[model samples]
Target chain A: MTEREALGRRRRVVAAVVASLLVLGPLAWFWWSSLVPANASVMDMGYPDTGGGPAAASGHGHEPEDGPRVSVATLTGPSGGVPDVELTLTADAGPIEVGGRTVAGYTLNGTSPGPTIEAVVGDLVQVTLVNRSVPDGTTLHWHGVDVPNAEDGVAGVTQDAVPEGGSHVYRFVVEYAGTYWYHSHQVSHAQVRGGLFGALVVRPAAPQEGVEAVAAVHTYGAVPTVNGSTGDLRVDAAAGDRVRVRVVNTGSGVLRAWVPGSGYRLLALDGRDLHDPGRVAEQAVLIGGGGRADLEVTVPDDGSVRVRLGSQSVIVGPADDAPDGDDPRSTLDLLTYGTPTDVGFDPRAVDRRFDYAIGRRPGFVAGRPGLQWTINGHTYPDVPMFVVSEGDVVRMILRNSSGQGHPMHLHGHHLLVLSRDGAPSTGSPWWTDSLELAAGESYEVAFVADNPGVWMDHCHNLPHAQQGLVAHLAYTGVDTPYVLGGDLDNTPE
Target chain B: MKTAYRVLAYLVATGVFVQAGAIAYAWFATLNDLDGGAVIDSDWEGNLGHAMHGIVGTMVIPLLVIALLIVSFFAKFPGAVRYALIILGLLVLQIVLAFVAFGAPVVGALHGANALAILGVSITAAQRVPRSTTTTDASAPANAVA
Candidate 1:
């Protein structure tokens, strides 16, 4: 062979080697950086975002110079008290009947929506979760209940997941009367979607005269259902009777509820009653994922009133059949719906302010490549740790530039909506645990840091949370004993 | 190396056709569902066709294009690197257009057009490999001595 040919061959080999390195180098780095340690503490996982607060805050525990440290395990409710409401729920992995099609899902006591646990305000509720056959383990999270930190039931954050053949007890007092829910927090994204949830209703202390029904909506596979049934929820009521329907959105997206043939009043949101809510005929209430709306309607003397919940409906009146109505073109604006009243504390007197700006970009999360959700422009394990102190009035601005909507849920506390899109709330103060933010929409909300614990603030679309659209509302001096992705495989999505 | 480049390039071209077919099926299925009283709200996570389109567009085709680029360097074909680079650039633009289409749906037209550009360039890259392979086969005896 000629010398020139040999030189050309050598150069080609070198070029190929260099090109391969150029292609493979960054991919290797991304995969390596995305690897999360099996047993890692949430305290050390991400960077601390102090929300412009003092770095050496007085009560913070991790600083080592603080007064005292409180482990998350010891933040329990009264342990040795007689419980007013007690129930044992057995969680098993099995088939759930959705529209007569048996789909593989988890169940409690052999049923999907389980049993509705009802209690009165000021009553102590004790729930024992017995894991019978679930392979990955499970824990029950009180959706809207402001239980103690130990009773919050977040696996890997507040407590360990109950393994198969094991049991865990959760005890807490029912402080407020509202519509709430309980679902497994371990592998929550998959387990909650697969029917491991039930409704929790707490009635007020005063005696009320009305017909009440809890309509917990969930989607089993492709079929949307209300109270584990595929068809409309039929409530037999006499003419001129008032039916109060509590609609709880347990699924992954926003649900619209409207009553046709009769005017309805949105009595409550999340779990708190609104102040002087007026009647509306054509407007529909938008319930974010993991949110609740209580609707009251007085049945007309003519026929049935159908409470349309998107595809599903709640039929209330004397007749069996109610014509389905088209969905309302406009949603009921909560910002201007009811009369304003005192919400106890002032929202302008804020202690610490935080900005949660959500966006989306192509990136790697846990070693997988896709268009991933981001919190404050950072992905999972690199997200913000929103630090706060007990008794502090915390104001947060939630902005969604993520090209889609997100139902943001903050555990252990409820936020009062102060403003939306820079417009102050002109109606009743909106109290909610799950606030839905559409693309390019922003909201300013405030809440008191009454419940002290490590809490999850994240998108309630379970799959989105699993994709790392999560942050934490951590109180000062609170630390958890458990770690994520540990020996027990605690995946608290 | 020549064969690997050709196979990867053709696979990328085939992926464009699959993406088009899957997106078409997704819209048609959505229309059928809407007719059957299904509400297409924020809760709707699309049908199986949409899932196929997402997986192929994001994961499958991008990997194929990267492999084709690496193989082009060692394939010993004229303009092989240039064609691979052009296809890669088009694929990157295609993804950007897809994301932009989410907020402004009119950009979807550009996304569709870019997919055709990727298909044409990748096919051109694959077609060029065979002619170079024929030339190499004829000169195989001289290279064997080296």
Candidate 2:
């Protein structure tokens, strides 16, 4: 080859080498960076633990020194003659049998929907939670009961998780009477789905004479169960008996409850009774995840009353009798159900109004690729902190455009449904801690900020919550001493 | 050899515009991502933009190298060969600058700024190529330009 030709070939070779390096260099770096562990703490990711202190040795952070302490002594009922109901619950994690299927799950008192604790209004309910074998710690969050801030059971926030072999006591007076539940807040996404939950019923002062049953609905390893049993749950009742079925949706999906054999009244919702609830036939009630619905059914003269929750049936009569026929699509709309009553607080006098628009975006979550859940277009750790002062009436416009339903839940307060899809609610006072939102749906809810604490307002669909569908409802003058994604592996979702 | 050179020039030129389009789309997607204030699951656009930018950005390297190799063989298009080599060098520098930009915002801005220069040089080199063999024959002798 000539000298010029050799020089020309060398130039081409050099160009190729440079080009190859240009392409491969960045790719190699990206692969290397992805493999490296994320050294930053949750607080470093723009969410600082303003109320900072060293995390407790038990893997749970302590509340700020100035924050209110919830002790067993302070949770006592008023002196003299108030009936006190006390119980002990142990949380265990292992392979457990449910609905004929042995699945791995966390359990309370050796059962999935732990024992139901029943009490009357004004009764002091004291429950000691003992963490026996649950690794990663556990704390019982009273789902709907408005307990003291310290007894709220949010690990690292309200209280540190009760370490394994350690115990904590939750005491409060049953002020309002209705169906509520308790579940773990530590690693809640795994623990709650694994079955660390139970139902709590507070009866009214004047107890009505009737046959009552708590239908705690949960999904154990993809199987729908009612009161820990799959298929039909039978309760024998005479023709004239008034049967109250309290349906609790513990899973992260909407559950439709309907009585196929008898007409039923929508008695209560989210632990609050409806005003003059009227009887309705051939309609189902949709209960949001982490929400509850109480239905009263009158047994037929002979045949069984089949109350179906999702695919599981609760037969409230003879076992062999056939279920009555009705179109399941004829679902009851609770927004206009029952007589309308004064909600006491004027929603128009809102102190703070915020728009919570839920959307989905394809992005990196903790350096991983997937479609992530967003609140107001921002993913978790970058989500909005809906700030309010104590006693402020806050109104939130929740719009869902994410192509799926999100059962939005707020801790520490129950929001009253003002309107849905721009239509004003004309029914009884509708209150909820978990409000279900369908895709393309909008809802306006208002709540008085009486409870002062840094509370989580997030999607109750625990998986979505983990995918960044979470935000904080921070009260002015209140801060959380806890940090997320630390050594404790405190996954509040 | 001249025909191969022309084809590679055209391909590299097309790739330059594609890279430009990808970068433009990425910029628009980033804007959309920023506007996603509080909306969940809106990161798809941003992620798509990043992927497109990376893919097109990496693709430019080999396209430029092939154009350089083919143009070098033509011998008459010495200016085209020089431009191709310059673009390849810029691309390498741009990749390094982009990684550096992760830790320094100012460097990132420079990385973005250098991309336009690379595009300009790529297009210039593609324009210098003869549209057909007839044009190449009608032009000056191979040793004249060199």
Candidate 3:
């Protein structure tokens, strides 16, 4: 080979090597840049150097401009025994965005899942529901409301589904407090799944200070509103202030939860007080349908805490809180503007604990997704029936192995949950019916085997409950004739 | 004279490997950004990790393959041809062994066989090549008089 040719070849090789190096340098940079997780905890991402670069024209990303806003903070109400509540529901039944797609829904005030109803124990609630959607109207059934006999929403029994554009007013007293929800009486699966149900947080008669709650709306049809998982709302307090967090699973799936970075101790569940509240420290509270727990959690050090929402989080921080009764400040406080709250979870304080499992049973004969609910892998029966013995410290472990959610209901009795999603509901404790248990979720509740006779534990979606997803929690009785249901004529014998 | 070029070529190939390693590392770190579960940490960490996977997965592996090729090619010195082919054969065997050994009860046996083959042939090739030892025969003249 000629010397010139050799020299040229060498030069070409050198060029290729340099080119490769140049290419690798940028590729390395690109690789390094992308390696960081999208959600890497930026809490410690280098502190902003506040005054560096000549700030460019600010409007970079078309960030949504915050407009007229409102916050949900403190709510004041006249003190009394509020066992029942009533409201006129004008359901604007129509198509709405759920899971990003528009689908039919039973919305109150043009919103799916209705409005959030906050009430305390000993209050009477009267609701008049006007269904303006489906060809066949609907009846209002408080999924987990502690109400009277006549007001029970059973189609053809309690009252025929108020015809379309028809109205029915339900009046009942709030017997307990906790995380309860409401939905249609019959054919509710289709409607509630389409957006008819909502959160009903019943607080204690003497509410705990700095305790707050938010009804997290879960819908596959709708993207999300506020709380990503347990719903959205925040509370702020100075260090040592007891912070209560009540989680209500309103979707058709078992909801798993934890405080993420925050810590707290659980106190009670299902409205049933604890034999010893200290057990909540190490106890994992799992609330079945119609259950509630009071958690006692101290605020963390000044900074921000992102409440883990399954796979996401809602940022909670130590910021200024609204003075005594500033409405807007209260609302903004719900969005996490609160002062330092020095509170730590006392693992020894939890007095009660139970085991709940979330599992699914596949039928070899069937191909479709089968019934998904909780309570020891058993689906609730259509005609509610149960067998229970007295003197049993009823520790009910609700394991939802199914793909859908079931809000188990205990007719006459209430149980208390010490923790939720393996985390305790710090300070906020109340009672009610219809605790929403999401799919693949588990909850633990304990109650005295006190309420005799057969009680109902089933999905709140009346249709799902009606379709054999109901169970009977019956207490044994040999002294007299064991009768079930408040009115025999309305319920099947 | 030609050896100088070969030596330089080997250095270039080695550089490619280091660069590839850096690329692979980048991909490993960004996995979470891909909206993929925390292949590392599953939290609110968003989906950028996956979006950058293309750069790491695509750009790095090819460069390493080229480096390996260069390394294999230069493995052509005195006994390099025979030694390289044997080593190459063992490499292929190890790859096959790795596949067969996966989830198999005979994994330990397969691994032992792979190590033996690589070591036996490599030693044989070394024996055939000129050694730097004092008793070396090939590098010195068989007959000093000639």
Candidate 4:
């Protein structure tokens, strides 16, 4: 071969090597950087976001050794006392009937939408969880109850999941009376969707006169159900009787609920009563994922009333001929629905301000490349750790530019809605634990950092949370003995 | 290496076709659902067609393009490197347009147009590979440009 031809061959080979390197180099780096350690503390996972408050000396690392340390395991409810309400729930995997069709799913106490647990205000509630045939372990989270950190039931963060045939106990005091729920938090994206959940209702000290019902809405596969049944939940009521229905959305999306025949009042939200809520008619109420809405309706004298819940319905009065409702075009704006009242705490007197900006960007998560959700432009484990001190009034601005809607949920605290899109909240000092934010929507909320522990603040759309749309609100000087992906194999999303 | 480059380019072109078909199916299915009283809103989880489009567009085609770029260096065909680079550039632009289209759906028109551009460039790149050329030596007629 000629020297000139040989040189051309050599140069081509060199160029090939360079091109391969250029193509593979960044990919390898991103894959390596996206890896999360099998066992790592929630405290050490992400960067510290001070939220303009006092900066931690450790910068989201371990607490300063010189200062006193508090472990999350020590944060518990009152102990060594007789439980006011006690029950045991067993989780098992089997083929259950959803909408009269059998589906492979998980169940609690031999039924999906397991038995409702009722309590009065200021009563101590205790529950024992027993995992039976579930391959993946299970832990029950007291949704919107604001239990102590140890009783929060988040696997790998608050405690380890209960393995098969193993048992765990959770005890907390019910401080307020309204609608709430419980669901498995381990492998929650799948377990909750498969129906390992139930309703929790707390009543007032005085006996209520009206008929009460619970409509725990869930979707098993593509079948929407209420209280584990496919058809409308029927209530036997006479004419001129008053009925209160508690609606809980356990699915991973927004739920639109409306009444077609009779007007209803949105009595409560997220287990809190609205102040002087007026009557609502011809408008649907949007309940975000993991949210609750209490509606009060007066049975019509002539016909039955139908409450449309997403894809399911609840019929009151005579069940034989209930009026089916249409999905309303207009939604009730909670921001201006009720009369305003003092919310007890001043939102303007804030100690910390944080920005939780949700966006989507192309990146690698756990070595998988796609368009992943970002919290403040950073993905999981590298996302923000909102640091706060106990008793501080924290104000946060949540912005969603991700071209999708997210029902943002914060554990252990109920955020008071101050405003949305710069418009002040004129209704009943709206409070929520799950706040829905659509694309290009922004909300300002405030809450007191009275619950001191490591808490998860994530999207209630479980799949999105698994896609790195998760962050945490951690208190200073507080650490946890548990870790994610540890020997327990706890996967908490 | 020349054969590998050609196969990858053809695969990318086929991927564009799959994307077009999948998105079309997704919209048609969505329309049928809406007609049957299914509310399309934030709560709507897309149908299977959208999932297919996403997987192919994001993972399958991009990987093929990268492989083609690597093979182009050693293929030794005239204009092979230039064609591969153009295809890669168009694919990158296609992805960016897709993301932007979400916030402003009007930009979806551009995304649709760019997909055609990618399909065209990918086919052009594959055609640049000389037909039935097995010889890799310097004496082969395929290396005349070199």
- Candidate 2 lDDT over A153-272, as tens digits, reads 877556667778989988777789999999998888889988999999999999678798899988775556788887677888878788999999998878888877567998999999
Cα lDDT of model 3 by residue, A1-493, tens digit: 6898577556645654564465457645534532323221111121211111221221112334343211111111223443356567777667776434565566765776677777778777766788676554565566555454235554433345566667766665676666566666556556655566666777789956674555353543324443322234455556556665555545544333444434545544444333334322212344433244445556556654433323333444465321111111111001111122322233233323333343433211011122223334433221212334544455556666555556666555554544555664444333335566665556655665543332345555444554445544433331112112222212211
Provide interface RMSD per model, one decimal.
5.0, 13.3, 17.9, 3.7
Best by the lDDT measure = 4
Worst 10 residues of 1 chain A by lDDT: A55-64
- What root-mean-square deviation over C-alphas does model 1 reach? 3.6
lDDT of 4 by residue, A112-205 (tens): 9888999999999999999998888989999999999999999989999888999998999999899999999999988998989999999998
Instruction: Report lDDT (Cα) of residue A176, candidate 2.
Output: 90
For model 3 chain A, where is the 10-residue window of minimal lDDT?
A: A326-335
Clashes of 4: 0
Candidate 4: regions farther than 4 A off:
A1-12, A57-59, A62-64, B18-50, B101-113, B131-146
Model 4's DockQ score: 0.39
Give the whole-model CA lDDT for all candidates, comma-separated. Answer: 0.87, 0.72, 0.44, 0.87
Tell me the lDDT of candidate 3: 0.44
- Evaluate chain B of model 1: give its TM-score: 0.89
Give the CA lDDT, 0 to 100, for residue A322 in model 3: 17
Isolated chain A TM-score, each model: 0.96, 0.85, 0.53, 0.97
- A121: Cα error in model 1, Å: 1.3
